[model samples]
Target: MNRYYWILGAFAALVVLLAVGLNLNPREVPSPLVGKPAPAFRLAVLGQADKTIGPEDMKGKVWLLNVWASWCVSCRQEHPVLVDFSRRGNGTPIVGLNYKELRGDGAIDMRRVPAEQEVPMALERAAGWLKEHGDPYLLTAMDIDGRVGIDYGVYGVPETYVIDKAGIIRMKHTGPVSPQVLNEKILPLVAELNK
Candidate 1:
């Protein structure tokens, strides 16, 4: 029947569309960098005089590299976990990348554009939020020009990386790095590195 064939064709097209949409979603791929040496470069911590932070600085210690921007609300959610990781991970250092910008102007820092519209929380509001919530970065690098993020392939915030003493990327976590990632991945790796 012609009507039956038309329905079948429509169903097939819908299936194809769903497949393509899901495949293109960034969340499907867990991480972009794992089991690779982290790239080396220096970036300045805004409002700090003489204390530039970078991959080279982390070479001597096992550390958590957290890529976040002022505008990322989810980053706020994971900030406390990062503070805990900094304390528990063999006193491992925490590196922060405030991604995207010509330079962090104290008001605005660089961040990526999300595929879907995130509830737009401006950088200023996010900064105030952090001050109220607390900052987790032991050494925060103001990633002006977004080059550092591009090097690290940080598509968006709340991404955390575990880096070993020799600068190898032990793990990469996409999305809000919860307490689970800290317990399962970060702490274990730091314990291993310390031993």
Candidate 2:
């Protein structure tokens, strides 16, 4: 019947659409927040809870807001690049948003690793990791509950945002910052925004 044929056609179309979506890279996913004002949040600094930081504090400066987690493997991959970039002191400041650091059962990864060896997911743990791995952030804010991350449309860890001096989000890079991404996308944008 024609009705049966129509149902088959619709099913085939859905299958094709799903296949295309699966092939798409998540990193290339366009952000709705691009060209919009960065989300605002004031949170306690990782190591210093008494001191808070937010978008308002960096209103007049071009900055990189790097959302990282101590547990994210991709963050480790990008750590050296961020560290080197921070040391270069290219005029753009780097701030860190430490998101979802605490876990009720203390499980940090999907591997289901034992809790005894699992890294503690707390602000102190993040501060320690930064100290041992080399702290690159001019200021680091703690988002233990990940509410701020939701506001910024974060899909996962290791997302980086380039905010212009006026506090507008110019670009967002999802995933580890490879040298090529830093050189080709971030650095050039930083130079342009600074000017």
Ten contiguous residues minimizing lDDT sum, candidate 1: 115-124
Taking all chains together, each candidate's TM-score versus the true structure is 0.69, 0.80
Candidate 2 minimal-lDDT segment of 10 residues: 102-111
lDDT of 1 by residue, 110-194 (tens): 3554523222333343355557767666766766567878888887676888888888888888888878877786677778977
Q: Candidate 2 lDDT, tens digit per residue, 18-130?
A: 99999989667899999999998998887765799999899988999999988788899999999999999876789999877764224555356455533334766788889
**Runs in model 2 lying further than 4 Å from the true structure:** 1-24, 104-121
Please report the candidate that would top lDDT against the real structure. 2
Whole-model lDDT for model 2 versus the true structure? Answer: 0.86
Model 2 lDDT at residue 87: 91
How well does candidate 2 match the true structure in TM-score terms?
0.80
